[model samples]
Structures are given as structure tokens and as C-alpha cells.
Target: MTSTPEPWGPVEPLEPALSVRRVLTLERVLAGEPEVVAGAAQLDRPVRWVHVAEAADVGVMLTGGEMVLTTGVLLAGDENAQAEYIRSLHRAEAAAVVLGLGRAFPTTPDVMRRAAERCGLPMVVLHRPFPFAELTEEVQSRLVRRKFAAVSLSEAVRTALTGLITAGAPLQRLLDEIAHHTGCPVVVTNLAHRVLATAGERPAVDDVLRDWERIARQAGGSEGDGWIRAELGGRGERWGQIMLCGYRGDTAGGRLLADRAAEALVLHRMLGGTSAHTWEEQSAQSLLTDLVSGVVPARQLLPRARAAGLPVNRRTFVPLVVRDGDPAQLERMLRLLGLPGLVAEFAEGAVAVLLSLARDQDADALAAHFATRLRTESGESRTVVAAADPRIVWDDVPTGLREAQHVADAVADSSAALDLPAVVRLRDVHLRGLIRLLRDDPHVQSFAERELDGLLCAGAGDDLLAVLRTYLASGRNKSRTAQLHHVSRPALYRRLEAIEARLGVDLDDFEQAASVHIALLAHDAQQA
Candidate 1:
């Protein structure tokens, strides 16, 4: 499948947060160092950066990197308070605390001094007054210098790689060297988009696929179409993402820069991983290659299969396809699948579901029941078609995927012709292909138009589908259905009667129920 299109914008490279080593310290400032503020303590500084405040609890509220200025107004009123405040500052990991020479205490409180010494936190006392703005300007200038250096370094690396490529140099050594220098996992994706090399612990493919779409979108179509774009923690499990805790000194540029570097590394390898293969450019074609070449080898498959928590040595795989639209509905279905032994991947607007081997001959029934349960939970009028085949080990995955595709396609095509409600499935068809199409056509569209025209015209198609889907979920239990919809049973009955009357189908009759069910599946397919 094609990656999601990235949002359009002018390409801006991101950079990492300023290193603690780059900041100046209070001691350095007092010593007449032109750059006075600790780099870790300075924020938004073009000169030396300092903060002077008496807020007692500034420690927890702080994000380090500041030459903390305090008038000692909040000095510990008690021995405990003094120690606690100092401890909190230490925990906040501030670069240094600079106390004004004159404050609430006659001298540096013994307790405060002890606390700072115990915590190994830096403490400074200003003997002379200095303008806060001037200090800030100096610190900011140093930060700008650091950023410029980083940019220059990044450009140098880029140019070196480009030159190497132009000279047809081997990339493996270059990647290893880069990984060593960066100290981050280095992954090179092949021209076919399969990961060809990696320098860190590997993560599962399913986990990677989860964020791949978002990464693709952010990179944008044209922005990273042929070139590289970077982002942070937006894709996969390893090198994926992590909570920043708080915004702190993290600038948007820094976050972007880290991720872009990752993207660049991946793209560079993807472009250079193999001999230029014109055919591998297509995602679909690459998918075929990954399947045929056993990119996810049988040896790796078992670990992942076990990770998925599938039964060992069990055979048979069923592929289930999820229809698109309605994110809420998609979310509900996804929630039911936190268990292992099931592998799912999103292709286009649909999610492909893989079911491991079943226990017995009732595999199809089990699969159907599992699917039906998911449908009920989602309360969506979407199609879930399953293509089942006898249990095959991972070595036989290529055949399974191809077969599943055929089954899903068949179900999708056949269901379109039915006069069903909002949901459809492959097994819903008693016959295959054209015959199934004829059976569902009227109920699929015409019948739905007749019965649901009000909702359709009111642009309440979603609401109508939800209601219909929920009705099925409740097993047509009017009381339970009423409670879910917050409507009385009488009202629900009336609606059901209206639906039956409009469609000329009686719910009580088996033939009508079967017909309506088929029709619903067909309607959903056509919409899909």
C-alpha cells in the first residue's frame, strides 16, 4: 500500500535540545566569563540567561537550564522546609541556583547551605547587580552558536554521504560509522522499503506498521517524496516515540531535527540498499517481494507468532478485511484485538486481520463468531469478510496472503449486489460472484433508499447505520436495544416496524431475516 501522504509545508530541519555542556555556570559568570549562564540553565538567551525569583516552590516548576535568581523570600521558614526546597531544586536538576547577596536571611542559611552541599547542587551569591536582559542576550548568543555548529555538522554529513553515493562507494561502512557517531540505532531500508540493515535491537513489524502511516503523512507527499524528511518518535516501536514529560527546553526544531535524521538515514539506505530496481518502486510490487523473498523469515516468524500468542504448531490462517470510514467504529473494533496470535496490517482503507490455527473442524464457525462479536462491539455497518484456508506454517505465508486477498475480493465484489443493511461479509453469500450480486442488489441500495431515505436525506446515514448495526448487536433484543439508544421499547418497536414496512420484509420470518442480512452486507459493500 502507498504510504499516507504527508502534510504540505516548507521543509524545516529540526534540532535537538541544547546540551548541558554548552551552558555557562554561575561560577563562570561571576568569574567574568563573557558567556555566564549555565547552558543547561539558560533559555531564550542571546546573552547570559538568569532567573531571579523568590517563589518558594520554583524547584518543581522549573525545567532546568536557568541561572535561577531568588530573593530568598521563600527560604525555608523551618529547617525541614529549607532542606525540602533545596532537595526539590536538586531533583529538578537545575544547573545552578544563584541567591541575591541580600535576602530574608542575615547570611546564607546554614540549613540551605547544608542542603545544597548534601545534594551537590550548585549555589551562587551575586555580589553586584546585573541586568537580567543583558544576561539573557549573552546566553542566547551562545545557544545560536551551538545551533549553527550543529547545522554545519549535519550539512557536512549530508554532503559526505551524497559524495559517496555519487562515487558509488559501499554504504554499509558509512552507515556503521554514522551509527557509531550518532549513538542512535541506524536502520537502512532497502529500495523495496524493507529494512536491510539495523544497528539496534529489532522491533516487531506489526508494531512498526502501527505508526508508519502517521510518519508517511507528516513527511508529506512532495516534501519527502523523493528526498528525506525527519520527525521524532512518530513511527514504530524502536526509535518510535517517547513521552517528553514536559515541554521544557524542547523546541519544535530540535524534535523535527532528530526525526529527520532518522528519516534521512532510512531513506538513504532505502535508496542505496540494493541495485537500483525500477520494479521495486511500487509498494505493491515490493510487498510481493517481501512475501516471496521471505523478508520475515520462518525462523523469525515463530518468535512473532508466539509473541502474538498463537498456539504452537497449529495450522490454518484466516484473513479478515475491515472496511473503511468512521474512525470511532474502527477504534472500537481495534480494542477487541489486544490479544496475541493475531496479526493485523492496514492496507488502503481496510485492516487485514490474520487468525492463527483453530482447534478443530469448526474453524470457520469460530472465525465467523469471532468476527460477528467484533462487529457487534463496533456497532458499525461495515463489511468483515474472512477468507479461510487450512492451517499453514509461516513458510506458507505468501500463499495465505494471496489466497486471503482473493477471498476478500470475492466477498467484496459479491456483497455489492445484495440488498442488505449496512454490514457485509464474505460467508454471507450462499453462492459466489454474479449470483450473489443479484441477491443483494435491491436490499443493498433500492430497499435501503426506500426504508432509510429520511436518514439518507437528513445526512444521518451514519446515525442510521449505527442504529441498524446496534440492533443486530443486541440480537434484535428490543429492550436492550432501547436502553442503548435511550429510547423506550415501544419506540424501538415502532422503528423496527417502520423499517419492515418500508422494506416489505418481516423480521419474524426466517426468509426475510436472511434476505435483510444479505441485503445489509451488500449495501455496505457497495458503499465501501
Candidate 2:
């Protein structure tokens, strides 16, 4: 037995066209019995206007996307001229060509029809006598009406978004309004490409964010069906972008919605005195400061961190301290790397960043990468110091931060006189770093004073002290020290002999030289 055929589903309605289509049922033109002789498949091309041109070079007089009304008066016998006329209109991007019949060969010219077919330019012929004035008036009026409707729609969207902003609606509410108007997913992101807010059906939002890294990479060019973004901010200070995902509308309409939403969000943030970006940074800074101070236990601070959108329980934490780098640039870089972290201005001339690492990631490698990026971005004047604890527990983060801070402080103190690596760590600073940490103690201060008292009180300036520092720092190599101080060999020897005599120590003795070196490091640390 044969199965019954299934009933067909209802057809979905077509979206409204931005401009009048060439195949639009023009009642006056159709009453004259027009025949579409070529490019029937392209009859739906948009026509911005209707123009009458009897010249052979009419294409020069027209802009793109217009339907030309002609009578073939100039090319009634010449086939090449007919072909060239059709080719010119095609090059000018004319929507369609309408020819009035009974005066030019009583039918469409074979050369013009073939040319239109080759160029995919729709060609229509009126079989009966038709007035070009009537058709032009009808099409022009329709085009004007459509243009007005589009302007009205844009104004309506702007008013709605403005009202929402004036009412003090939150960011999510504003995004939701945009989504409602566009019937698509709306997203807001900072310059770093972190998703700040989203509004749409849950599944649609998830689909957009599922491959966010790829999407972010492609966001530099907004020429696709996936997403379109409108920049936010003014006066050359671009703070973020508003994106419309899966917007199934004309590009003009989608852009209108995105621009209105972006404007509303910017105004909302300005009126509220704090943006979502600023608030998030402030929250992270507060949490990090509290963690470093050890005023609250790690377990107790977990809830606050989670509320601030930090992933704490299953992540590896690396504490980093950067000297002479901008905190804002660091935050932007972190967002670009898709690494969530807390960044803030710590002490004067120092920025602290607490990086959240995934389970499989290496903290040291990431720290090195971050340091290289910082150097490349901010130049060699900046230094980055990091501490990576093998134990990835939250309880250890406070200690790690202190360690990193100490390393950074020591590196900054010594960077002026010594050439150090870009990425500094605890091992790089060694004994001098340890001594700097204890420089404030009474015993350490006393030792440093006793070891260098003679030089300190010799009525001579820091010249001899400078000589001793270079001498000790160069591993007691006289020639190397002379090269560093830009002095002759005899002058360097005399300076070294004077230093040894005043300090009451033998320069040839390794133990005595080591003691003096330690004393000098302690004094420098205390001074710093």
C-alpha cells in the first residue's frame, strides 16, 4: 500500500526590503504589459530610483542601484551599440532596464537581451505604449516612503533606548531592550573582550559564547553574519564595544540598533559615576589588598572572590608585581590573553597582578610570557617579578604576594647600577634580596655601620664608596672594576688599596671580601 503524503508546513514570512525590488508589482507599468526577457532570477534586485535616459552613455549620468526607463531611440539598428549600452548599465550597477516597445524594432533587441543575460542585469520590455512619467512617479514615491519609514524606525529605537537610560535602567536591562527590539543576542564587552553582559534566550547566548576565543579573534573585522559591533566612548577614548549576534536584519537596521544601544550604555555608565569595568577592577583590587594584608582568612575570603567573578577553588594562582608599568594596560593584556586575574596599583610605582591559571597551565611559563609582553609593550624600563608556589592552595597566596613584592622591591633598588633580566624572581635576587628584607633590623643596621664606618667618616665624598661597590660587585676583578668605573689600572689599584686599608680587611682574603660585600649590600638596602 502507498503511504499518504505529509502536509507541507506553513511558509515563513519574508523580511521587509530596504529598497523597492525590480520585480515589485508596479500596477501602472504592469497595465502596459511588460515582459521580463532576461535575468528573471535577478528580478528581485533593489532599485533605489527610476530614471529616464535616451542618451547612449546614460550610465555616466546615473549612480548605482537605479532602474533606467528608455525607448532604445539611440541604438535601433546598431547591435554593438546596443550591447555596449547594456554593458555600461551593468557596470554602473543599474538594478534593471525597462524599454518602451512599438518604436524600437517592435521587440527586445537580441544583442541587448544577450548582454543583460550575460551580466545578470534584469531587462524588462513594455509590449504596449507606456508613459515613462507615470512609472517614474510611482517608483520614486515608493522609494521616498521606504526611506522615511527607515528613518522613523531608527528614531523610534533611539527614543526607546534613551528613555531606558533616563530611567536609570541597569546595563542588563538596556541590553535586554535591544535584544527585544532586534530579536537577537546582545553582548557588551570591554576593550579587553571580556563579556560583561548578555541578553537573549539562554541557548542563543550560549551559542555565541561557546567558541568565544575564535569569535574574539575575528572581532577585529565586523564583516560577517555572526556578529557586528558598535564602538563605545567618545573623544577618542574608546572604552568598549556593544555587539549584536545573529541579527537577522538588514545591515543598516542592525547598525542602528547597535549604535543606539552603545550610546545608551555609555550614558548610563557616565550618569552612574562608575562603569561596569571600573567596578569590577575596584572589587578585585579590594579583594587582593585584603588577601595580601592577611586581615581575613583564605576560606573566609572565598565567598567574596566568587561574588567578584573569580575562579578560586580549582585554579592555580600566580602572584606578580610589576615596577613602572601601567595597571590599565596590564588589565587589557590579561583580557586579551583570556586569562582572568586581579590587577591593581599597589604601592607607589608598583602594580600587583594575581593571575588565575588553569589546571594544566604552568605558572612560570605564563609569568615569563607576561613579562615579555610587558617589556614589549612598555619598553625596557619596566620590570616584572613573579612568585609561583608549587602548592596551589588559596592559603599560600598571601605569602606568595609578599615574596613577589619583596623580589620586585629588591630588583628596582639594584636595577639602576646592575643590568638585570626582564623577568625577576626570588632566585635572581639571591642574598641581596634576603638582606634587604632584614635591612630594618637593629643588628643588621649595626653591622653595616661598623663595616664601613671608616669610609663613611673619612671627610671624602661617595667616590671611595662607589669604588668599593663596583669592586665588590665585579667579583674583585680589578680590571673589570676599572672598566666599569672608566678608570686606569693604576688609579683602580690605588682606590682598592685605600678601601682595604680603611675597612681594615685584606682584599685577597675570600672570607673578608665576602663579609664586606654583604655589609655593602645591607647598607644599600637600608638606603633604598
Query: In terms of lDDT, which candidate is strongest?
Result: 2
Candidate lDDT (C-alpha), each: 0.49, 0.77
lDDT of 2 by residue, 1-528 (tens): 333222122222223552434334768877888888998888767777788987888889889988899999988998888999999999899989988887676977889999999999988888889889988888777667767766776676667667766666656677777787777888777776666667787567766766566677788885568477899897789887889997887666677668877887888888878776674565566677888889878666664555345667689988888887677899988887788788887677777888888889987787778888877777665455555353488888888887777888888767345556656777778897798678889999999999999798887638999988878777788898899889999998888888888989997999998988888899998887
Residue-wise C-alpha lDDT for candidate 1, range 1-528, written one tens digit per residue: 333222122233334444333333434455432222222233333222345556667776877655566657666467777677777777877666765545465456777777777776666555555454555566667667767865765565555545544454444444444444443344334222333333322452334333433433443343322123243222453332211111222344433334544544444445666422221122223333355356666455443343223444656655455544333343344345442233333355554555665555465665566566666765654555445454556677665554555445555554134544322343444444323344345544676455445445555446555566567545666777788889888887877776665556677777766656545554554565
Show where candidate 2 strays beyond 4 Å: 1-15, 18-22, 26-35, 40-44, 222-226, 273-276, 279-355, 358-528
Candidate 1 vs. true structure, TM-score: 0.34
Clashing pairs in 2: none
Which runs of model 1 end up more than 4 angstroms from their true locations?
A: 1-21, 24-48, 52-65, 69-95, 98-112, 118-120, 124-137, 143-316, 319-353, 357-388, 403-528
Best by TM-score: 2
TM-scores, one per candidate? 0.34, 0.53
lDDT of 2 at 451: 92
